[model samples]
Target: MLQKRICIIDDDPIYKLITKKLIQKTKLYSETIEFNNGNEAIIYFEATSDLPDILLLDIEMPEMDGWEFLDEFCKLEKRINKESTVYIASSSIAIEDKLKAKEYKCVKEFLSKPINLDKLQKIAEQN
Candidate 1:
Protein backbone atom coordinates (compact mmCIF):
# COMPACT_ATOMS: atom_id res chain seq x y z
CA MET A 1 0.00 0.00 0.00
CA LEU A 2 1.13 3.56 -0.68
CA GLN A 3 1.98 5.80 2.25
CA LYS A 4 -0.46 8.68 2.55
CA ARG A 5 -0.78 11.78 4.70
CA ILE A 6 -2.64 11.46 8.03
CA CYS A 7 -3.91 13.97 10.53
CA ILE A 8 -5.39 13.38 14.01
CA ILE A 9 -7.41 15.97 15.91
CA ASP A 10 -8.22 15.38 19.56
CA ASP A 11 -7.97 17.17 22.89
CA ASP A 12 -6.77 14.26 24.97
CA PRO A 13 -3.04 14.23 25.19
CA ILE A 14 -2.72 10.58 26.13
CA TYR A 15 -5.01 9.45 23.38
CA LYS A 16 -3.20 11.63 20.92
CA LEU A 17 0.18 10.31 22.00
CA ILE A 18 -0.77 6.66 21.95
CA THR A 19 -2.71 6.86 18.72
CA LYS A 20 0.00 8.85 17.01
CA LYS A 21 2.51 6.16 17.94
CA LEU A 22 0.22 3.41 16.71
CA ILE A 23 -0.44 5.27 13.50
CA GLN A 24 3.28 5.61 12.95
CA LYS A 25 3.70 1.90 13.42
CA THR A 26 1.48 1.22 10.44
CA LYS A 27 3.92 2.94 8.11
CA LEU A 28 0.92 3.84 6.07
CA TYR A 29 1.25 7.60 6.36
CA SER A 30 4.01 9.63 4.83
CA GLU A 31 3.46 12.24 7.52
CA THR A 32 1.18 12.67 10.56
CA ILE A 33 -0.07 16.04 11.74
CA GLU A 34 -1.87 16.38 15.06
CA PHE A 35 -4.02 19.06 16.68
CA ASN A 36 -5.15 19.45 20.26
CA ASN A 37 -8.57 20.77 19.26
CA GLY A 38 -10.93 20.90 16.36
CA ASN A 39 -10.45 24.60 15.74
CA GLU A 40 -6.71 24.31 15.34
CA ALA A 41 -7.15 21.31 13.10
CA ILE A 42 -9.67 23.21 11.01
CA ILE A 43 -7.34 26.16 10.70
CA TYR A 44 -4.45 24.00 9.62
CA PHE A 45 -6.58 22.10 7.17
CA GLU A 46 -7.75 25.36 5.69
CA ALA A 47 -4.22 26.60 5.08
CA THR A 48 -2.36 23.39 4.40
CA SER A 49 -0.73 22.66 1.08
CA ASP A 50 -2.80 19.54 0.58
CA LEU A 51 -5.45 17.72 2.54
CA PRO A 52 -4.35 14.68 4.45
CA ASP A 53 -5.27 11.49 2.67
CA ILE A 54 -6.62 10.21 5.97
CA LEU A 55 -7.95 12.26 8.87
CA LEU A 56 -8.66 10.88 12.35
CA LEU A 57 -10.85 13.38 14.18
CA ASP A 58 -12.43 13.28 17.59
CA ILE A 59 -16.16 13.87 17.89
CA GLU A 60 -16.01 16.30 20.79
CA MET A 61 -13.56 19.11 21.46
CA PRO A 62 -13.36 22.55 22.99
CA GLU A 63 -13.60 25.74 20.88
CA MET A 64 -14.99 23.93 17.85
CA ASP A 65 -16.77 20.61 18.00
CA GLY A 66 -16.39 17.99 15.33
CA TRP A 67 -19.71 18.90 13.77
CA GLU A 68 -18.77 22.54 13.60
CA PHE A 69 -15.38 21.65 12.23
CA LEU A 70 -17.11 19.58 9.60
CA ASP A 71 -19.32 22.48 8.67
CA GLU A 72 -16.33 24.71 8.12
CA PHE A 73 -14.25 21.99 6.57
CA CYS A 74 -16.91 21.02 4.07
CA LYS A 75 -16.67 24.46 2.51
CA LEU A 76 -13.02 23.80 1.67
CA GLU A 77 -12.98 21.47 -1.28
CA LYS A 78 -9.25 20.76 -1.21
CA ARG A 79 -9.32 19.37 2.30
CA ILE A 80 -10.50 15.88 1.41
CA ASN A 81 -11.39 13.28 -1.09
CA LYS A 82 -15.10 13.06 -1.73
CA GLU A 83 -16.78 10.96 0.96
CA SER A 84 -13.70 9.09 2.14
CA THR A 85 -11.06 11.23 3.82
CA VAL A 86 -12.01 11.80 7.42
CA TYR A 87 -12.92 9.29 10.15
CA ILE A 88 -14.47 9.94 13.55
CA ALA A 89 -12.69 8.48 16.55
CA SER A 90 -14.53 9.11 19.76
CA SER A 91 -15.28 7.76 23.21
CA SER A 92 -18.98 8.35 22.74
CA ILE A 93 -21.25 5.42 22.11
CA ALA A 94 -24.19 7.66 21.45
CA ILE A 95 -26.15 6.47 18.45
CA GLU A 96 -27.08 10.03 17.64
CA ASP A 97 -23.46 11.09 17.31
CA LYS A 98 -22.67 8.22 15.01
CA LEU A 99 -25.80 8.82 12.97
CA LYS A 100 -25.10 12.52 12.78
CA ALA A 101 -21.58 11.89 11.53
CA LYS A 102 -23.08 10.09 8.57
CA GLU A 103 -24.54 13.38 7.41
CA TYR A 104 -21.06 14.41 6.30
CA LYS A 105 -19.95 12.53 3.25
CA CYS A 106 -16.26 13.19 3.89
CA VAL A 107 -16.48 11.16 7.07
CA LYS A 108 -15.23 7.75 6.06
CA GLU A 109 -16.46 6.01 9.24
CA PHE A 110 -16.76 6.30 13.00
CA LEU A 111 -14.40 4.30 15.15
CA SER A 112 -14.40 4.30 18.94
CA LYS A 113 -11.59 5.71 21.09
CA PRO A 114 -8.18 4.35 22.14
CA ILE A 115 -7.83 3.62 18.48
CA ASN A 116 -6.86 0.09 17.60
CA LEU A 117 -4.06 -0.70 15.21
CA ASP A 118 -6.31 -3.04 13.31
CA LYS A 119 -8.86 -0.33 12.83
CA LEU A 120 -6.29 2.10 11.45
CA GLN A 121 -5.08 -0.56 9.06
CA LYS A 122 -8.66 -1.20 8.06
CA ILE A 123 -9.27 2.49 7.49
CA ALA A 124 -6.21 2.66 5.27
CA GLU A 125 -7.54 -0.27 3.31
CA GLN A 126 -10.97 1.26 2.90
CA ASN A 127 -10.00 4.84 2.08
Candidate 2:
Protein backbone atom coordinates (compact mmCIF):
# COMPACT_ATOMS: atom_id res chain seq x y z
CA MET A 1 0.00 0.00 0.00
CA LEU A 2 1.07 3.58 -0.62
CA GLN A 3 2.35 5.19 2.58
CA LYS A 4 1.72 8.81 1.80
CA ARG A 5 -1.78 10.22 1.99
CA ILE A 6 -2.71 13.36 0.09
CA CYS A 7 -5.89 15.42 0.28
CA ILE A 8 -7.23 17.54 -2.56
CA ILE A 9 -9.80 20.31 -2.10
CA ASP A 10 -11.28 21.71 -5.27
CA ASP A 11 -14.64 22.27 -6.92
CA ASP A 12 -13.94 21.21 -10.47
CA PRO A 13 -14.62 17.55 -11.06
CA ILE A 14 -12.50 17.37 -14.22
CA TYR A 15 -9.54 19.03 -12.55
CA LYS A 16 -9.78 16.72 -9.57
CA LEU A 17 -9.87 13.66 -11.81
CA ILE A 18 -6.89 14.78 -13.86
CA THR A 19 -4.91 15.68 -10.75
CA LYS A 20 -5.65 12.34 -9.12
CA LYS A 21 -4.47 10.52 -12.22
CA LEU A 22 -1.29 12.57 -12.39
CA ILE A 23 -0.44 11.98 -8.75
CA GLN A 24 -1.08 8.30 -9.16
CA LYS A 25 1.23 8.27 -12.16
CA THR A 26 4.02 9.60 -9.94
CA LYS A 27 3.51 6.81 -7.43
CA LEU A 28 4.15 9.34 -4.74
CA TYR A 29 1.00 9.25 -2.64
CA SER A 30 -0.48 6.04 -1.39
CA GLU A 31 -3.92 7.47 -0.77
CA THR A 32 -5.77 10.31 -2.44
CA ILE A 33 -8.88 11.82 -0.86
CA GLU A 34 -10.86 14.50 -2.63
CA PHE A 35 -13.32 17.17 -1.45
CA ASN A 36 -15.52 19.35 -3.59
CA ASN A 37 -15.17 22.25 -1.25
CA GLY A 38 -13.18 23.44 1.76
CA ASN A 39 -16.12 22.92 4.10
CA GLU A 40 -16.34 19.28 3.23
CA ALA A 41 -12.61 18.92 3.62
CA ILE A 42 -12.77 20.56 7.03
CA ILE A 43 -15.46 18.17 8.11
CA TYR A 44 -13.36 15.25 6.98
CA PHE A 45 -10.39 16.48 8.90
CA GLU A 46 -12.49 16.95 11.99
CA ALA A 47 -13.92 13.47 11.81
CA THR A 48 -10.78 11.57 10.85
CA SER A 49 -8.12 10.61 13.33
CA ASP A 50 -5.33 11.03 10.80
CA LEU A 51 -4.81 13.90 8.46
CA PRO A 52 -3.22 13.67 5.02
CA ASP A 53 0.47 14.32 4.60
CA ILE A 54 -0.21 17.02 2.09
CA LEU A 55 -3.14 19.19 1.09
CA LEU A 56 -3.75 20.57 -2.43
CA LEU A 57 -6.19 23.45 -2.17
CA ASP A 58 -7.98 25.60 -4.71
CA ILE A 59 -8.78 29.27 -4.26
CA GLU A 60 -12.26 29.17 -5.75
CA MET A 61 -15.20 26.96 -4.84
CA PRO A 62 -18.91 27.14 -4.06
CA GLU A 63 -18.95 26.39 -0.36
CA MET A 64 -15.62 27.43 1.05
CA ASP A 65 -12.66 28.91 -0.78
CA GLY A 66 -9.00 28.31 -0.04
CA TRP A 67 -8.63 31.50 1.96
CA GLU A 68 -11.58 30.69 4.16
CA PHE A 69 -10.31 27.17 4.68
CA LEU A 70 -6.88 28.33 5.67
CA ASP A 71 -8.36 30.75 8.14
CA GLU A 72 -10.52 28.07 9.71
CA PHE A 73 -7.83 25.41 9.42
CA CYS A 74 -5.41 27.51 11.37
CA LYS A 75 -7.90 27.61 14.18
CA LEU A 76 -8.17 23.83 14.28
CA GLU A 77 -5.42 23.16 16.74
CA LYS A 78 -5.82 19.42 16.50
CA ARG A 79 -6.15 19.20 12.73
CA ILE A 80 -2.61 19.47 11.44
CA ASN A 81 0.56 17.94 12.73
CA LYS A 82 4.08 18.94 11.79
CA GLU A 83 4.30 16.04 9.34
CA SER A 84 1.60 17.55 7.18
CA THR A 85 1.89 20.31 4.60
CA VAL A 86 -0.37 22.44 2.42
CA TYR A 87 -0.10 23.92 -1.06
CA ILE A 88 -2.27 26.35 -2.94
CA ALA A 89 -3.19 24.85 -6.30
CA SER A 90 -4.92 27.57 -8.18
CA SER A 91 -5.44 28.92 -11.68
CA SER A 92 -5.29 32.43 -10.31
CA ILE A 93 -2.60 34.65 -11.78
CA ALA A 94 -3.10 37.53 -9.43
CA ILE A 95 0.03 38.53 -7.55
CA GLU A 96 -2.06 39.52 -4.55
CA ASP A 97 -3.45 36.06 -4.17
CA LYS A 98 0.00 34.48 -4.29
CA LEU A 99 1.23 36.91 -1.69
CA LYS A 100 -1.76 36.19 0.49
CA ALA A 101 -1.01 32.47 0.40
CA LYS A 102 2.54 33.08 1.52
CA GLU A 103 1.12 34.53 4.70
CA TYR A 104 0.03 31.06 5.77
CA LYS A 105 2.76 29.09 7.50
CA CYS A 106 1.49 25.68 6.45
CA VAL A 107 1.45 26.59 2.78
CA LYS A 108 4.61 25.48 1.05
CA GLU A 109 3.95 26.81 -2.45
CA PHE A 110 1.40 28.20 -4.86
CA LEU A 111 1.04 25.99 -7.92
CA SER A 112 -0.54 27.02 -11.19
CA LYS A 113 -2.91 24.87 -13.19
CA PRO A 114 -1.67 21.92 -15.28
CA ILE A 115 0.74 20.88 -12.56
CA ASN A 116 3.41 18.83 -14.35
CA LEU A 117 5.61 15.93 -13.36
CA ASP A 118 8.51 18.24 -12.61
CA LYS A 119 6.42 20.23 -10.15
CA LEU A 120 5.11 17.10 -8.54
CA GLN A 121 8.63 15.78 -8.19
CA LYS A 122 9.72 18.96 -6.52
CA ILE A 123 6.79 18.76 -4.09
CA ALA A 124 7.65 15.17 -3.32
CA GLU A 125 11.27 16.06 -2.62
CA GLN A 126 10.23 18.70 -0.11
CA ASN A 127 9.41 16.09 2.50
What TM-score goes with each of the models?
A: 0.90, 0.91
TM-score for predicted model 1 compared with the true structure: 0.90
Candidate 2 error regions (>4 Å): 77-83
The window of 10 residues in a row where model 2 has the poorest summed lDDT is 75-84
Candidate 2: give the clashing pairs. Answer: none
Per-residue lDDT over 1-127 for candidate 2, one digit per residue giving the tens place of the 0 to 100 score: 3357888899999999998988898898788999999999888877774678888899999989999998878766344554468889999999999999999988889999877877776777776
Q: What TM-score would candidate 2 get against the native?
A: 0.91
Best by TM-score: 2
lDDT of 1 by residue, 23-121 (tens): 889888788889888789767766753567888889789899888888877877544543328889999999999999999978878888878899888
